[model samples]
Target chain A: MKHTLPILIRKEVTQFRRNKVLPRIVVMMPLMLVLVLPLVTQMDVKNISVAFIDHDRSPLTLRMESHLAHSNYFRLCEPVGSFEEAEQMLDDGKVDLVVSIPEHFERHLTLGDPKPILLEANAVNATKGAQGMQYALQTIASAAMEKARGRGAAIGAEQLLTVENRYNPTGNYRHFMLPALMIVLLILVCCFLPLLNIMTEKEHGTIEQINVTPVGRLEFILAKLIPYWLLALVLLAVAMLLAWAVYGLLPAGAAALVFLAAFLFALCISGFAVTIANISDTMQQAIFVMFFFVMFFMLMSGLFTPIDSMPRWAQGITYAFPPRYVIDVFRSVYLKGTLFAELWFDFLMLTLLAVVFNLLATVTYKKQS
Target chain B: MDNIITVSNLTKQFGSFTAVDHITFAVSRGEIFGFLGANGAGKTTAMRMLCGLSKPTSGSGSVAGYDLRTQGEQIKRHIGYMSQRFSLYEDLTVAENMELYGGIYGLSRREVSDRVDQLLTALQFADHRDDLVGSLPLGWKQKLAFMVATVHRPELVFLDEPTGGVDPITRRQFWDLIRAAAAQGTTIFVTTHYMDEAEYCHRISIMVDGQIRALDTPAVLRARYGADTMEQVFYRLAREAKRGD
Candidate 1:
């Protein structure tokens, strides 16, 4: 079995080299994600177009408009003369928000019964709309507070909360996304490569030749997986290099611990891929099965959204996914410099997944059939 | 002569359909045994049982003195199989294919290198050793596949329509290689749809609808059916077959 494994791996490597497109794609995918996706997803809504219509035209109203313009989030467009003109600008998509001051704005403030200013927002994209409204409100509230203090009136004490973001002081999104993207790339190469490799053998009829030989089923599966496993590790290293060069991010924990977790995670995914390949009779069937599982795994893995925010049942399903554990390990290792002792439970689960998946794959693969 | 393969009342059923029904056959050592049948006539199914690839539904068989039931791994080790698909890794080179199969059969590294060298030289494939098998013509690929299958020097080899898509000249050359292997005392069990190729076997069996309808020497079968050729003998039996699929 030892001798056969090297030969089988060599054959796979040769075939992999012969296919000119795959190697390039494997390298390029991670590099593109590292370079491009971070820049795209780092977008914090800024330069939102705002139109102002001041009915009172009072000094306080002018002060509020100036504050809204000076704040980084809003970009003051041409001031409109009437509410109709502001509404027309919004309808034309010229501004994302419209701020209007009512006629009694100064009078109400003088009487100590300040009326609220109307801030209309385009709610087509709900998240953007909500964030824009919050920022606008903060600017208007501060402007009102400054006006009250200038009038020599006793102002109420406001509670101030100072938030210190640990681990990431600057709140760089790449620090969070790069590690997760690395895990995603690892999953793609480790799972899909072996799945397609085995399916190709079946399609080209070489699987029947191997089946008729005295080669053990487990040996054959191992031989097929080891090459992709090694390739995924190599790709991981390249991705790390790209991360450092492009984003200046590196794992804060022991590199060995991160790699150990990656290795186990890769093995588990590869075993799952092999089992899928064993059960599927054709390439299309195998691809469909892989697609279904990978989609589910990625969705429930907390890659894009927080697992805690998901519904209770959906959160329960995330426990069954191997990527969820691996993603946690990656984030912990990369950002927090988490020790192995702190991540022992995740490590144990990954190791267990590896063994169970490989055992199932070996038992289900039938040489005689 | 010692029997290399022996079977009695071997049967295989897929649910209600009997693919190979209560068949019995034997082949002596160093003999060229030809298995002939129409499409879906159960020739391949029966050969799969004898090669230890599939278990018989209810019967007994032995190949190379190993039990077909319990010792399938041993049977596999002692025999080589070349399927109708010409099962060679197309992306691998000719020499690499030989090395892989040689290693699979548990040959030592030195043994694999030496045997691969000798086989490449003998087959005149030395010039194309490093070229991908996919780049080779169909005939050369078939020949290379045959060589790879027998690289470990097994005692018996099963070839399933090895010359299916080759030209007549290449087919003739393939037969010469088979004859040489048989001359070296390696038993050859082959299946073919070409009647002329069936005539080259020392003994042939024509299957019809999962049963062996004729099994004898070519001359004896021709005389018994009063047919001019093995093709007519096959038609005579196949015409009366009741099974459609």
Candidate 2:
């Protein structure tokens, strides 16, 4: 038992290296995620088209139009002569938003009875529409405030509420996305490698040879898992380096803590993969089962969205996903410098998942029938 | 001679269908025992039970003096099995496959290397020691599989249709390896569809419908059935049996 595992691991690693395409894919996937995914998902919804119909044509309205045009978030189209033309553009999908300044807009402001500024947003893509509308609102509000302050009217500070975005002061999206991408890459490699490796052996009839031997069941599974586990760690290291070099992001907490989390997470996923392989009789069955579980785990892992924001039942399902804890630990440690003491729940969850998955894999893998 | 394998009323069933109905047999030490059956005739199923790969549905058996019911692990450690698929890791080199099986059988590193070198040289596979088993021709692969199965020097080795799809020349060469192993006092339990190969066995059992219809030496079976060839003997028994092929 002592020496059998090493031999088996060596055999697996040798076979892994011998495969012409799989090793390259395993390494290239993480590199692509670290280098390319962050850039792709870093989109901030810029250059939104806006059409203006200013009836007043006053200096105040003109100033508002210029301010909206100069802002990076909105692309101001040529000033339309009438509201009808602005509405036409909106309906044609040429513009995402329309701002209309009513007649006598500046006169009402001088009398302290300001007329409402009507804004129409094309909400075809709801999130983008909402974001474009918010940008337009901020631009107009700040322009109005500048005009009021220029006239020497006292603007009350009572309604102002100061906001602070701690930890990620700049709200760098890369910092959030890179860690999530790392988790995703790790889960994919760690899970599929062992699943496919074992299934391939079964397909090739090599498993029957191993089954007839005296190799312990746990030893056989561990031997099959350790190669991919170590490969996943290597992938993690490469991804971390690429993240720092390409995105300039690093974990703010102890590097060892990040490694610990990644190792535990890899163990949990690989164990789950082995269990899948054990139950499946063919490569197709294993791949389909793996695909189903991986998709479910990724969606419920809160990698793309927050767990708390999901529906109550959906959030309850998130607790069953092992990657959810890893993602939480990754974000906390990377951005907030959270220590182990504060992250005991995540560590405990990951540890429990690892134990359960590995035990199940070992128990489910039958050497004799 | 001491019996290396003793099976009594061994049976296996899947739901209502019996695959290996209560059949009994014994194999003497260093003897070449041939287990013959048609497709789905329960030869492989019976071999699996004897190899400890599957449990008997009823009755009792022992392999290498280990109880089939409780000492399956011990039984496995003491026996070698080669299935019809030629179960060698194709992705691994010839020497690597040898080392892997040796290591699994709990051999020391030095012992594994020494045995691998000796076997490769003796089998004229020294030049291809580092070549992947997949790159080798089918005949060489089968021969290498046979060698790897007996690398641990087990007291008994089970070969389940080891020559299923090989040429007659290759099959003849394979039987040479089996005979050579038997000469060294390693009991060889083989199954073959080729009647000529069955002729090479010291004793052969023809099974029909999950029951052993004939268990005797080839000469004895031929004389009893009054047939000129083992194929005639097999056909005579199979036709007389009250079962559809």
Candidate 3:
């Protein structure tokens, strides 16, 4: 076969540009999400007005008060001299978490007894409350251990199980999210767009016209994938520039590594997208199906959350997700500054996905009889 | 000439829907064979199977001397197919569409340029080469779509309703192109609901309710059915086929 993939890719690019919506989405999507969105939106959760109910007034309870006061996760709002002050603060949407240390908290804890700490959190914002509870637990455990160590019990087994968060210092939500968002956006414009293109041809009768020629299935497939792949890379580069310009954060690893990982991952994305195109009979159906795919991918790929935080079956589902692999490479490069050698497993999964998708598309693409 | 298209008990189904029932036919090389049917009468389904787009649920067939089931890829390489829509990417130029089809078929850059020049010259559309197809009129697009379909000069070309929307003038011009393609030794397998178009074919098969109720030339079908014209012949056969069903 004397097929020239570049010619086909150029033709697809020409077609894509002529399609007004696709070009606009590819160019403007990241800019809207990354820069303009961030300027409009905020991650700052500071100066939260919190209610305090100090029953003990002990030195130890005072220490806990200082921890919440100094922490970015909370602020002291009201002290419930009566039950109504704290209740009013909560009802007015002021305090998010209510901590109740029983009257004998310090006395029991200091006298070799484990103390019960009662805390209530807003159910509407349960995740935030969960994070707050986590922080509170760590803070109390460390403080009690420090006091115990001063009492010369620093060698306690409970003190040894300290939680360490070394990789994502400061736990910036944007840092955690930006890399995963890049993968999701790539899938949307990359896989979803081109697959829609292929399927639309079938629906509109264009593929039948094209098939009458000597066009090889492989060449046709390359034609379908290459243009969108390059467009996706351009989208990637734009997002990369935006990530740095907006967040003041360049990916900490090699540029070549990032590009190659993204390129290979795109094959999987486009390949699966073609199968979706084959299965769907209309552009609306294809787009609707793509929404389901993107939603499931984002949810399962640990884009906005941690995979380890999910149930085991959900974690297992991530193995089937192309974004999971893309996210793996993304975090390794952006967060860990990891080299390609360190991400061989992720690379391998993406390569496998590429092969699997290609195989499925090839199997699905039919011409005449 | 020996038949370039041959079928034996060709069958196709989707779930419980039987589109193409067991049908047998052979089409001679270089002959324009018309597939006539009312809407959803299995003509497109059978045409797709012959072109290698949809597999037969059972039975067997061969096109361009290649067994369809085992050598479909080879068969696809040798045959051209114009779908019912006769659709082309309006966003692409005439030359762009030609080059795209050429490249898709694995033609080299030089080959594409040469074929494009020849096609543009033959179609008398060299000046508007760079203009996108969307700018072209419906008649021009239909003709251009026909030209693109036959650009590879495959051994056989399947035209499925290639003249649906165009005016009678344009439709005649389309048949002239089809005739020219056939004259160049390309066997034409075409489908149409138009009785006049059916009369132009060397032989035609009339499909009704998933069965070929009549398979003969326009003259033969008219004579065999004792009707005045192919139109009357088709109506009678359709009535007969529906009664049989």
Candidate 4:
């Protein structure tokens, strides 16, 4: 086993170097994900572009107009004369929210029960458009309150200024995206390498070479595991270092602990990949299987959205994904300076995952059965 | 010669279809035994069970004195196999590929170095030791795949259509390596459709549809079938099987 270790690692690295796409898909991709992807990817939902039509021509409607102009969450893009004009602006993608102060606006307000201001919100984009409409209503309501009650009975300004975003205090997108990307890329590289490695053997029929050698089933599996495991660890190290050097996102936890967790995470992911490789007879089938899991894991891993924002069932489903725990451990350490004790459960789940996947691969593997 | 391989009613099935039906055979030490069949004729299936890559459904064999059923680990420790494709790692230098196989077989680092040195010197390509195996010609790659397969010095070696793509000259060179290994006391269990290749084997078994149709030396198979060449004998047997089907 000691003799085979370096030999396998060297062989894997040599093979990885020869294959043009493998290393890029593994290491470079994750680095790019962390650096390039999140900088431009938007997360904030503020300052929605909307248009208004105040046909009432009254003092109350004018006050409402002034209120919208001052609101931070909205930018009133070029108001129009009629509701149809606002609709045309929305169709042309100029405005996301269309607000109409009704013709009976003053009459309704004097009765002390105003008819609702017509708000047509485009719900196509889901988040930004809806928030834009909500902000418009809130600003208009505050204006109405000022008109109904004269000056001097104002509520005191209460300071509500406590905010600390967990993983990104500096609000750095690279710091947030890169840490999660390290996990994604390591998995992409390590996971798919083993899958293709084994399937290529089977396709070329070198599996028979391992079968006849003095290497046992356990030995063969472990030998293949070495190259990929080391490659994944190296990629993980490089990714973290890149994050640190480029974005100034230092690992809050010990570097050694982060490495150990990441190392174990590779084994879990590689085991699952090799199991797929063992069963898939062709490279095409192997890649299809890998793509399915890669998409499923990355899209639902709670890297972009808070788990709280997900439906309860979706949040529950992500628990079964190994990347979920892997990402949590990474963010906990990278963003919060969290120690191992604070992140013991995530680490434990990852370790358990590694064990389960390894055993499952071993058990499912047999010579000819 | 002592029996190096023993099989008794060894069978394997995928669901209901038995790939290798109950059949018994043995090969003596240093003998070149042939496993012949058409495509999907259960030749590879039988070889896989004996090699301990797959489990037998309801039979047993002993490979290098280790029970195939109960001691696959013990079996693996004493066998070598080569497939028909370019099996050597194309990315690594020839010596590195040798080191990997030798290490996996429990060779000491020093032993791998020694064995690789011996092989490179004997093959008389000492300068090509560090060249990537992929850049080499097909003939060299085949020889290297064969050499690496036997680097651990296992008791038995199974060659599954090991020369399917190579030209006749390269195939002849590959046979010389097989013969040299046999001279070194390694039992060879090989399967090939090439009649000329079968003529060189010590004994040949012609399998059709999961059963051995003929088991004899190349000369005897021709004599019994009244055919001047092994190809004629094979053609006659295949025709008979097809007509029977």
TM-score (chain A only) of candidate 2: 0.91
The runs of at least 3 residues in candidate 2 whose Cα sits more than 4 Å from the true structure, single-residue gaps closed, are A56-60, A103-115, A148-166, B240-245
Best by lDDT: 2
Candidate 4 lDDT over B1-245, as tens digits, reads 68988888988889977777887888898899998877777888898888777888987788889898988767877888776566777777899889988988899988989999988787777899999887998888878878887898877888888888888898998899899999998999999989889999999998876777888999999899899999998887676554232
Query: After TM-score superposition, what is the CA distance of residue B5 in candidate 1 from its true location, in Å?
Result: 1.7
Please write out the lDDT profile of model 1 over residues A86-151, one tens digit for every residue.
888888888999998889798987886767689999989776787788778778777777887798
lDDT of candidate 2 over A1-369, digit per residue (tens): 688888888888898899999988986898789878888997467889999889888888888998998998899998789888899999999999999999999899778677888999999888788878877887887777788779898766532223456988866778888888999888888898889888988998889899999998888888888877788888888888888888678889987788899999998999899999999999998999999999988878888778888899998888878999999888898899999999999999999999999888988988888
lDDT tens digits, residues A1-369, model 4?
455555665666677787877665665675676677657675546677778898787887888888888877678777588899899888887888888888877887576565667888877888777667666766776776676566444433331113345557655556677767788777766787678788888876667666655455676777778776777787777777777777777887778777878888898888888777777778998899889988878888877666778899999988877888878888888777788888888888888988888888887775655
Worst 10 residues of 4 chain A by lDDT: A154-163
Interface RMSD values for all candidates:
1.1, 0.8, 2.6, 2.2
Clashing pairs in 4: A367-B53, A367-B54, A368-B53, A368-B54, A368-B55, A369-B54, A369-B55
Backbone clash total for model 4 is 7
Q: What digit string (tens of lDDT, one per residue) describes model 3 on residues B1-245?
A: 69998899998988998888898999999999999887878998898888777878998989999997878778877887777775888888899888877776677778889999998898788999999898998889878878877777788888889888889998998899999988998999999878899889999998887777778888988888888888898788666554233
- In the order shown, the candidates' DockQ scores are 0.77, 0.87, 0.50, 0.62
Root mean square deviation (Cα) for candidate 2: 2.1
Docking class of 2: high
- Model 4, which residues run further than 4 Å from truth? A24-27, A45-47, A53-75, A79-88, A91-93, A99-120, A134-178, A226-261, A332-342, B37-40, B219-227, B242-245
Enumerate clash totals for all models, in the order shown. 0, 0, 13, 7
Complex DockQ, candidate 4: 0.62
Which regions of candidate 3 deviate over 4 angstroms? A36-44, A53-75, A78-80, A98-120, A132-165, A253-257, A339-342, B13-18, B57-61, B106-127, B208-217, B220-226, B243-245
Candidate ranking (lDDT, best to worst): 2, 1, 3, 4
> Using DockQ as the measure, which candidate wins?
2
